[model samples]
Target chain A: MNPAFENITSLRAKLAARDITPTEVIEALRARCTQVEPSVSAFNHLDWDTALREAATADASLPLGGVPIAIKDVIAVKGQPCTCSSKILKGHTAVYDAGVIERLRSLGAVPVGRCNMDEFAMGSSTENSADGPTRNPWDTSRIPGGSSGGSAACVAAHEAIASLGSDTGGSIRQPAALCGCVGLKPTYGRVSRYGLVAFASSLDQIGPFTKTVRDAATLLGAISGRDPRDCTSLDQPVPDYTASLEQGVKGLRIGVPKEYFIEGMDKDVEQTTRQALDQLAKLGAELVDISLPHTNYALSSYYIIAPAEASANLARFDGVRYGARVPDGKDVLDVYSRTRALGFGNEVKRRIILGTYVLSSGYYDAYYLRAQKVRTLIRKDFEEAWKKCDIIATPTTPTPAFKLGEKTGDPIQMYLSDVFTIAVNMAGLCGLSLPCGFVQRDSTDLPLGLQFIGKAFDEATLLRASHAYEQSTEWHTRRPVL
Target chain B: MNVEYVAKLARIDLSAQEIETYQNQLGSVLEHMDAIASLNLDGIEPTAHASPVFNVLRKDEIKPSLPVEDALSNAPKKANDLILMPKIVE
Candidate 1:
């Protein structure tokens, strides 16, 4: 068996036992990347030379020793291109390592591939990537989900042992769900955002995409903690996540929000989610009915606030300082106008326009301010639910992965893909998505994710419950046939 | 949806066709934003951040800066020790 196919825990054990050197493991990973590239196209830029050089001397005692991590392109890695899968940053090499990258290196992980993503993390489907879309491993005809599509696909297809992804309105968890892997979004401020390119500053967070729940915990522990570079990073001491993995979910109150079971959700997805809930109840978890009345308004509020922030964040790429530039004339205004128009993709342009409209003078109070007010209500909804339950459970997404061109023409349908997952980001809380069940669709079995939302800086409970649930289920064991 | 004006403010030039298409597209998004407009927001405080960490002031001290070579590595246009841009004044 290729060492690359092993999860981090198993691989680490083998490396420690002197059964395989890091070179052999990385070589196997490179082979897998070559084998899977034709079908998955998971990476925007892959550097095996740097990976091998780093891995050759990795300290085996470190937590992630000799592991190859596929990083979402939005995160900076010094001397490597950080394109964010857009033409705007075509030749822009990162000037320094992001906080996560520094942590990953300190723990002996080799940051190998630049995973593809929706341009500037704007779209739910990775079809927005200028390089091309990353197809789902379960069914190539379908999308892997995004804008962390490449991050999830790399882990799913075994191109990398694990990956790092940023979640801003479901970018990490949603794609991890669609790809049948474990993805965790730490509580806002639980992880530093200094190196992550801003999508929506208030909502964006860095997290992990791993093959196993334990690997998720390990990776999260390695990359998380306070970084002085990011002021929003929580100063709380990092918990030993691996210590609580075996803690059972008995006597735990699992809240099932009625709002997540919307009318348009797929029938099979609904059935599988309910069955998983039943299994949890059978495992001694007390299922409680809960109401988050402001759930429906979350999407409306998110679209406004995220775009408004994105507009301000993305304005730094005006053909000056760095990034791709189009010299139109001697006039600086002409340069800014033409460069941005030529550099950005359609979706990005549309969002900039939307953001500008909301923040404009006449519409500021009506749209931006109103959305912020609605955001307060949405956070309160989660706060109210917390009073009754230890953890809130929901289907990670409304349905399994859809066909490549399924909802591309209509942006609203695309936006609806993140309905269930966006609110967690709005409230700046942590959430986890792990495989709980599988639904056979179009002659292929697609994975369904179960999400557990936890309180602020309360990843311990989320990891505990998800670990228990994962141990009881065989869904994570099923791998897609290439 | 005045896409032309919005694009101008965003520093992007849009074609006539793009303007027309964005008008319809952004119009629908605006319609969705209108949903929040109808809600009663009388006593609610706007939540720009969900965390309780406020006014995070740090010591005003100098830190290690990026090397000059690293800082200018990705510049599209560079002269000796400085970034070059199009002429701004006549």
Candidate 2:
């Protein structure tokens, strides 16, 4: 088997047996990248020399030792250009490692490449990337979901063994589902966000994209824990996520939210999702019909709350600081305005404006504040649902990956793409998307993702259920023909 | 609804075409927000953050800070250990 296609767990076993060295793995992946990366457009920047150098000295005994992990461009990796796939930070290299990178490095993982993403992680489709949209590996004509599209695509296409992607309103899970891989968005505060470029501070959490559920658990365990640098990181103890992988979902109640299977959703997606639930039931898991009454309001609340926070978080990108600065203005205000005008893409500007407007005078009470209150209701809905079920299962996306340029002209349509996944972020819970099945579109097999949401800080159960379902099915074994 | 005003508040200079485009797009996006606007959230407390964290304090001690050069490495314009911005006190 190609080392590039091998999951991290198997690679670890191989490395332990001395069947292959870390240097050989990097060399194999680099060769695979050379062959497939052009078609995938998954990476914004790749440094084989640096990755190889790290691999040569890697201690294979460490948990993630010598594993080449792709990093989404949003996270800071020392000496790497953490552009967030935007023109604003085109030449800005990270001066220090992000909190997750530091953790991964300490676990002996090699940070190999910078993956492409939405500019400032503002869009659902990776099409908003300044570098260009990362095409779905399954069908080059379709979009790989964003803002972690590159991270998901690279893993699916075997360009990287595993990659880290942040989830802010489904950036990680949605893309992972569309790309046919395992994507986990740990609960809010489960992973430190110190080095992650802020999009929505309250909603953002970094997790992993891997080829299997066990790999996801390994990566999540390595990167998760409290960090003094980020106070939002929970002080809760980090559990061994892999320890519970074999625990079958024999009596676990999986909540099926009626709102998630709504009218107008693609019939194929619903059928595939229902079939996956049936498979889980056959495996002895109970599918309880549940209602998250406030689900309808999650998208509206997220749009307001995320942008309001984004406008504030993004205010730091002025002319004098790090990143590209246009020097046309005579004064500070002119420079700030002119630099931003030329730097940001259309979607970014729209979000910034919407964010500013919502947080601005007169509109705050009506928009931002109201959205936050509605957020409280959304969180309460989850709290109530958890009483009836241990985990919530739903379609990761309403439909399979859509063709490129299909929704670019329509922003609302792009926003609607993340309808099923956004509520998980709003409630600040742990959500995992693994390959459940496939939908044939235009005679091509497009993958469908089944999302399993666990309560806040309850990733162990989430992984347990996901692993149970994944091992029972052949979907996770199926790879896109790149 | 004023696209230019919001752009000004955001410190971005939108082109006439962009302003026109955003005016229509923002209007429609906000129309979607009406879903939450009509909800009865009178007694619900607004959640500023999902994680229940307050002002996190640590022992007051000087820690190693980023070296000046590394801090200023990405600065657009720098002079003698200070980031040089446009003259503010003109």
Candidate 3:
């Protein structure tokens, strides 16, 4: 059979039938990595020898046995450095595997390497990576969306079968949408954050970025269970996500938020997102035009809340506790100053300062407290809308991947990248961005993604609607040329 | 809005060029934030977090942490296996 470079289920079935071996899969992945590494810069660390050794031990009974998976550098992989793509953590290695990593191992996934990301998961593009930018495989000059940029790029370009990514504020979905893949952000506590380096603790959740919804589903099924070690983990049971894949969205109510169709949204992106709705309607799903008025305030609320939380979570990284240090200092304060100065990137330092400023005593109520007040409005916006429909749909991003460094110099332009996504995070809803179509921007083809968000703990319906759309569309089947 | 304020907050010193640049960048971003500010949310309550359980988390409970050796092993400067650093008062 000509190699079908698609979903994990078919790949696993082939492996079970002895049509493909773990070694062959690993070898092909490794060869592809070597060929694409220079162009894509996907991985920060790759252990090919160890990967081959582990893949050689494959047992067919394991669900994902022999699949080569990419790990986002921000998540802990026992004994590997969870650097969060920063210089401060250059030599630090994780003492234990994250809960998600443990789940991946239980399903027999081979850890291929650590993919690059935005430094401290701060930027919308991988260009802010302390190590280097991970170039978009679709068009080298354009960026692969970030901070899960490396995982998205690697999976989209076939560097790996699937990869794990963390989404704080659109980190997973934005990149997946930009790169033509499926990315899911399970409910805030649906997946454990114990191994994920804290970006915005309350907002950060670990999820998968994959080429197909099935692969994404398989990975989510493995990692969705609660971990006692993580306090915020949901106490609910993990459902077999794949079991619902065949349950088509015949009666699902999919809502299209009218607020998302705002000015400055790329016309092609809007058209494709609408086309996805038409596809859903054809599949017997009902489309309702819903209003989420509070959506306008989501970004403001997120900036205050996320930064305030980040400031507190990151205070642990003093010169004394974890990460980088200053060799020379007159006192503890000096050490703290120098360490923070030397360790964090400009963007990180900006966030920390902004975070601290908002949380500071004098300005607390005006900024942080007030933002918190607006946050409730944002969630209620969804609550009212969800009462009328099961899932809400929007274009994942305002536009497809833009050229590298095009928006890097402008922080607002970069923050605008998450304009469509930040609200979902604020409302504490579950969302997924699945590739819906490709748009020709200039001379290059950039993949456009459609986002579906569900009420808290309503991921099953979101998946059903998304899966049905995927069944009818050929967008997710396309791959970037190596 | 001054360079010195940002420098002190970030714990870094910047040249005139960097200060001038950040002012412009931050200025525009903050201006764009006006859109989010102008949102009229009179009767609606703001949602700060997603979780339903409130104040139910247990008191600080100590659990197994990495051994001192393992924790400090990655430090660049150490004394008697302790992480040594530049010293000062807060």
Encode model 3's per-residue lDDT on A302-417: one tens digit a residue.
87778778777777676675677777767776777677777778777667767777777677766777787788877777889878998889999999999998997778789889
For model 2, which pairs clash?
none
* DockQ winner: 2
- Residue lDDT tens for model 2, A317-365: 9877788888767899998999999899999999999999999989999
Clashes of each: 0, 0, 10
What's model 1's lDDT at A453? Answer: 93
Give the interface-residue alpha carbon RMSD of model 2: 0.9
| Pairs in steric clash, model 3 | A331-B87, A331-B88, A332-B87, A332-B88, A373-B46, A375-B47, A376-B46, A376-B47, A377-B45, A377-B46
List model 1 lDDT by residue over A1-482, tens digit each.
78878999999998888898888988998998888789999999988898888888998778777887889999999878899999999988898899999999998888988999999999987999989999999999999999899999999988889999999999999999999999999999989898899989899999999999899989989988999899899888898998998888899999999999878678988888898899899888999999999998999999999999999999999888898888654578888998999899999999988988889998888888888999899889988999999999999999899999999877888998999899999999999999978888888988889999999898989998998888898988888888
Please, what are the lDDT tens digits per residue for candidate 2 over residues B1-90? 899988998999889999999999989999998988678887899988888889999889999988889999999889999988878996
Name the weakest run of 10 consecutive residues (lDDT summed) in model 2 chain A: A319-328
DockQ score of candidate 3? 0.48
Q: Give model 1's TM-score versus the native structure.
A: 0.99
Candidate 1 DockQ category?
A: high
Ranking of candidates on DockQ, top first: 2, 1, 3
lDDT assessment of candidate 1: 0.90
CA shift at A131, candidate 2, in angstroms? 0.5
lDDT of model 1 at position A28: 95
Provide interface RMSD per model, one decimal: 1.0, 0.9, 2.5
